[model samples]
Target: MSTRTETDSMGAIEVPSKAYWGAQTQRSKENFAIGHQPMPLAVVHALAHIKKAAARVNANLGELPTDIAQLIEQAADEVIAGELDQHFPLTVWQTGSGTQTNMNVNEVIAGRANEISGQTRGGKSPVHPNDHVNRAQSSNDCFPTAMHIAVLQAVTLHLTPAIKTLRDGIDQQAKRYEKLVKTGRTHMMDATPVTFGQELSAFVAQLDYAQTAIDNSLPAVCELAQGGTAVGTGLNSSPGFAEAIAKELAQLTELPLRSAPNKFAALAGHEPLVTLSGAIKTLAVTLMKLANDLRLLGSGPRAGLAEVHLPANEPGSSIMPGKVNPTQCEALSMLACQVIGNDTTISIAASQGHLQLNVFKPVIVHNLLESIELLADGCVNFQKQCIAGMTANEQQMAAHLENGLMLVTALNRHIGYDNAAKIAKKAYEDNQTLRQAALDLGLVTDEQFSQWVRPEDMLQPE
Candidate 1:
C-alpha cells in the first residue's frame, strides 16, 4: 500500500497517501481494527458541525486567523455534506472516550484545509489539526457534545416524522373501522366484543405516548458538553468560548442548542442520553406489541383468527405454495427487539463513567444512534409496506363475532350474570349459537335478545 510519513507528539508514523487522516489517526486506526462499522454518518456530520463552529468561534475571538478559519469551515462543510466521508476511516472501538474518532475528524478537516491552502496533505503548518481545527476543545467535551447533536438531529429528522406517520396511519384505520365490531381477546381467548376502531385506537394512543416521551427529552438532549474543554474545568478555553460555540452550532444546524449548565455533570455523566434511550425503548416496546398483535390478528386465512388482513409482501414458506406472510410486521418486530437490546447497552455504557469523564462515549453513541435509525426507518417501511395497504376482513370478522360465545357478556347487565352464564353454557353444550340457544331456553324474545346483546351498543354504553 502507498504510504507517507506524518508526525505527531509521539513522533513519526505512516499513513495511506490517499487518506486525509494524519499520524495520530493512523496510529489509532492500527491499534483498534475491531469493527467494520465506522462511526455513524450522523455522528460524522455532528463532528463536522462542531469543528466548523469551533473554527468560526475561535476566529471571532482572535484565537485563529480569519483566512485559516474560513478554509477550515470550507473543509468541514465538505465533511458535513459527506463529500469527505472516505477520509474518516476509524472504527467505533478505537478509544473509549472517542478521542480517536475526534482526532480522525480533526485530521481529515485539517488535511482538507491544508489542501485548500496549497500545502502538503500531512503537513500541519497552516491548518494544524489540534492548534487550529480543534482549538479550545477536548475529545472529552466534543465527543459527548457530538453525541447529543447527532441523536437530537436524528430524532428530529427521522424518528419523530416516522412515528407520526405510523400513528396517523393507525388513526386513519381506526376511523375507517369505527363501526366494525370484532371479538376482543384476553389471554388468547375470546372475552368480549370491541369495535375494530377501538382496538386500533389503543395502538394510536401508545404511539402518542411514545412520541411525547421523546419530545419531553429534547430539552435535556439540547444541553451540550462542548464548553468543558478538558475535565470540565474550561481551563484553556477563553471566556464565552463554550457559549459562542453553542450559538454558532445552533445557528448552523438550526437546532435549539445550548451550553451545558454544569460542565462537570455534562462531562462525567450521560443522563440525557440514557433518558432518550429509555424513550426510544418505550417506542420499541409499543412497536413490538403493535406488530405482534397484527401478526396474531392476521394469522391464518383458513384456520386461525384472520380478522385483519395485512399486506402480503412476501412468501411465508419456501415449500408451501401460494402462502403469504406479514413481512413488514416481522421486520418491525425484529427491529423492536434490536432497539430493546440497544437500550441495555446504552444503560450499561452510561453507568460506566468514573468522575469527570465517561470513557464509554463511543459505544453509547453508536448503540443509541443505531436504535434511533432502526426504529425510524423501520416505522417508515412498516407504514408504507404494511399499514397503508392493510384491510379488514369484514366477512371473517363477522363470522367470528357470530360464533364467539362471549357475546353473552352484554346480556349480563340486563338478565343477571348467572342467567347469562347459563345461556352461554347451553349454547356451548348444544353446539348452538347464542341467538339460537337464547330462543330455545326462553331467555327472551328475539327482539329483546337483539336489543340487549347488540354489539354496536356494547361498544360504549354511556
Candidate 2:
C-alpha cells in the first residue's frame, strides 16, 4: 500500500470539538453501532428546520441585537437548507434517552452555523453552539417538536395519499364487481350469496374509517414542545420565547403550529407520540384485514375459494409447475406485521419514561418513523399490483354460486323457511343437491322459483 500519507488530502472533514449535545450522543455512537437502521431522514431535516425556525423567532425579538440575531437566523437557515444533513449519521437503536440524536443535531447545527458566519467549523469564538444556537432548548423539547413535524408532514404527504389510493382501488373494484354474484364463505364454508361488489365495498368502508382516524389524530401532533426546555417548565427561556417560536414555525411550515398547552406536561414525557403510534396501529390493522381478504379470495385456482383472480407478479412456487401467488398481498401483510411489532416497541418505550424525561425518544422516533415509511411503501405497492390489477372471475364465481347449498333463501319466498330448511337438511343428509331437493319437494313452483332462486337476484332480500 503506497499509503499516500493518507492525511485526508482532500481536507473534506469538519471536526466537532465541543458537542452541542449534553452527553448521550457520545455514548450512543459507541454503544449501538451494530444495525444499519439509520434515523429517519425526514426527522433529521425537520430537526434542523426547527432549530433554524427557533433562531429566527429569537432574533426577531428586541432582546437580541439586530446584527447578532440576523447572523444566528442566517446560520440556522443554511442548516435547514441541507448543510448539516450529512453530519447526523447514526443508527436508530441508540440508547433510549435520545442523547446521541440530540447531540448529533446540536453539533451539526453549531458547526454549520459557525461556517456560515465565516468562523471555523465547531468554533465557539464568538457564537458558541450551545450558548447561541441551542440558546434556550434541550433535547427533551426539541426532539419531540421535530418528531411532531416529521410525523405530520409524513401523514399529509405520504400516508394519506397511499391510503386513499388503496381505498379508491377497493371502491373501484367494488363498482366493477357490483353485478357479479358470488357465494359468500364463512367458517371456511359457503354460507350465503353476496355480490362481489358488496364484499369489496365493506373493505372500502373499513379503509375509510382507518383514514378518518389518521386525519383526526394529526392535528393533535401540531401542538409542539418548543418552550418546554428541560423538564417542561420553560425554565431557562425568555418570557415570550414560546409564542414567538410557535409563530415562526407556523410561518415556515404553513401549519397551524402552536405551543403545548402545558410546558410541564410536554417535558414530562412523550404522550403525543404514544397517541400517534396508536393511530398507526389502527392503520396497520386495516391493512391486515385487507390482506386477509386478498389471501382468501386468491386462495386457490383449483382447490380453494378462488373467488377472485390475483395479479400474477412472478412464479408463485419453486416446486409447483404453474403456481402464481398474491405476492403483493403477502408483502402488505408482512409490512403490517412489522408495523404491529414496531407499535409494541413504541408503546413499551413510551411507558419506560423516568420521572422528568422519557429517555426512550430516540428509539420511539426510530420505530414510529420506520412504521410510517413501511406502511406508505406497502400501500402504494398493494394498490398497483394487487387491487388495481385484480379481476373478477365470473365463471368460477357463478359455479360456486350454483354449487352452494345456501341458496335456500330463494326458496324461502315460495315455501316457508322451515320447509326450506327441512328440505335443505334432507338434501345434505341424502347427498342430494339443493336444486334437486327443491324439485323433488315440489314446494316451489317453477315460475315462482325462477325469479326467486337466481343467484344474482338472491343477494338482496326477495
The 10 consecutive residues of candidate 1 with the worst lDDT sum are: 453-462
lDDT of 2 by residue, 112-231 (tens): 556567865554545555666676778788888888888888878888899888889889989988888888978877788888899899888888888887777777788898888888
- Poorest 10 consecutive residues by lDDT, candidate 2: 1-10
**Which predicted model would earn the best lDDT?**
1
Q: Count clashing pairs, candidate 1.
A: 0
TM-score of each: 0.98, 0.90
What would the per-residue lDDT of candidate 1 be over residues 215-284, giving only the tens digit for each residue?
9989999999998988998977989999999999999999999999999889889999999999999999
Tell me model 2's lDDT, rounded to 2 decimals: 0.75
Which lDDT values do the candidates have, in the order given? 0.91, 0.75
